[model samples]
Target: MHKILVTGGAGFIGSNLSEELLRRNYKVRCLDNFATGHFKNIESLLANPNFELIVGDIRNIEDCQKAVDGVDYVLHEAALGSVPRSIKDPIMSNSVNVGGFLNMLVASRDAKVKRFIYAASSSTYGDSKTLPKVEDVIGKPLSPYAITKYVNELYADVFSKTYGLECIGLRYFNVFGRRQDPNGAYAAVIPLFVKQFMNHESPVINGDGEYSRDFTYVDNVIQMNILAMTTSNSDALNTVYNTAYGERTTLNQLVHSLKEILAEFDPEIGNVDIKYGSNRAGDIPHSLASIDKAKNLLGYNPEYSLRKGLEEAIKWYWENI
Candidate 1:
């Protein structure tokens, strides 16, 4: 039995991963400060005896060491995510994403954890005008958040080489699903759009709506994480893989799909208006991933396309909110 330590386990992506691990009967320990995570996400998991919650912040070295003490694998997902937020407060984002991440790495290494898998970000692709972003080719980081994520990959590589720590970084694209918060100013586009549509409020598109993204579903991300943690291939151990669905959808297409799906539950949603604003700073014009490396190395097979993922996500939102 593997004892896995999931940092930020109360947050959207972390909570989803933790739930799936528990379903598979793994002993899971969740370390969260709840800075952005909601208690409602993990409230049910607390009842399970296999679940252990450590109310701690990863920024503190002692807290990180405590969390990794007896863990077999460390899933480092604790970070302040959002380009705008990082732009607003680079110091704070650095403290959490970079400073805290370093603490976790040191702690995991010291604890002799078998494998360390951490969340990387697509923002690392930055100003590169590439059609399908690859793992090796990258551009200059555009924002503080992108810089921090790029730093994470660099640190992971150095740790693997210098300390012999087995590490894998999963460079996630725009991931969305249940438990993703839709209220905050920094909320993701998909869930945020769904929430606005549910309320019959107009969703604000940042540009002319042609800007595209490889909006990945969270389940696909979970599959990538699991594969990264358990793979027997030595070549796959100390590298980063792009965790995405390998397709692109424009913001206009995304909005249309959301309205169509939500309209099934409430017809009036289709009538809701969409408003366009100036292109946001630090936002790329488009993003797409080349998943060939993940497929060849980790045997990655994505189960949901954007349409299928949007349907399930809309259903969950309708039922929960």
Candidate 2:
């Protein structure tokens, strides 16, 4: 059995990846500092013998080294993720996203890990008006968070060339699904809207409600990671792939869909109103991904669309929250 180390494995996406890895019978070691991750996310997996939790921060090289020791693969997901938060505090974001990322790369190289796959962000496609963002074309970063993620790609490339470490970066577009926190200040749009609708409060739209995104489901992201880790095609290595559902949903359409889905559980939720606000800084008008590379290279067939994934997410939130 392969022993895989998942950094930030207690976070929403990390926890999901760890759970699926364990389900597939891979020995999973989770390293998290609980900075932004909650124990409850991984609470259910504790009893599984194949699952191990390491309480450590990726910012610390020693912690990173310990996590990568004897691990066949490293899924580096431990980064401070939020464009607005990064804008508020770029130093902390850089420390974890960039500095911590470098630590993981070095540790993985030293450990001689088979492969290192990481959670890159679509935010790396900042300030580009390009529709259906392809892998090679990129624009100047619009936020500190974008800069950090872009830097991750650059660092991975250098590591791959210099130390012969195998690295793959999955640039996740607006990922949403179960266990995604909806209560935080930096809560993503889908969950946040669901939470507000559940509470019968008005969910706010940041712009004129035309901002669109290739909102990917978490399952697709997990599939990408697995493919990246296990692919035998040498040509697929040491590069980034846009992990998304390859469709755009405007904020207006998104809220309408959420209301329609959530209304099934509570008819009252459908009555909830939506408010409009000024556009957020560092936010582009529209964001979409071209998943052709991932589909062709990794055989990535995404299982969920926005409505489908939202249904699953709403079900989980209804049951748990």
**Each candidate's lDDT (Cα)?**
0.95, 0.94
Assess candidate 2 and give its TM-score to the true structure: 0.99
lDDT of 2 by residue, 232-257 (tens): 99989999999999999999999999
Compose the digit string of candidate 1's lDDT tens values, residues 74-171.
99888999999999999999999999999999999999999999999999999999879999988999999999999999999999999999999999
**Strongest candidate by lDDT:** 1
Off by over 4 Å in 1: none
Clashing residue pairs in candidate 1 are: none
Candidate 2 regions with alpha-carbon error over 4 angstroms: none
Tell me the deviation in Å of residue 190 in model 2. 0.8
What is the Cα root-mean-square deviation between model 1 and the actual structure?
Answer: 0.6
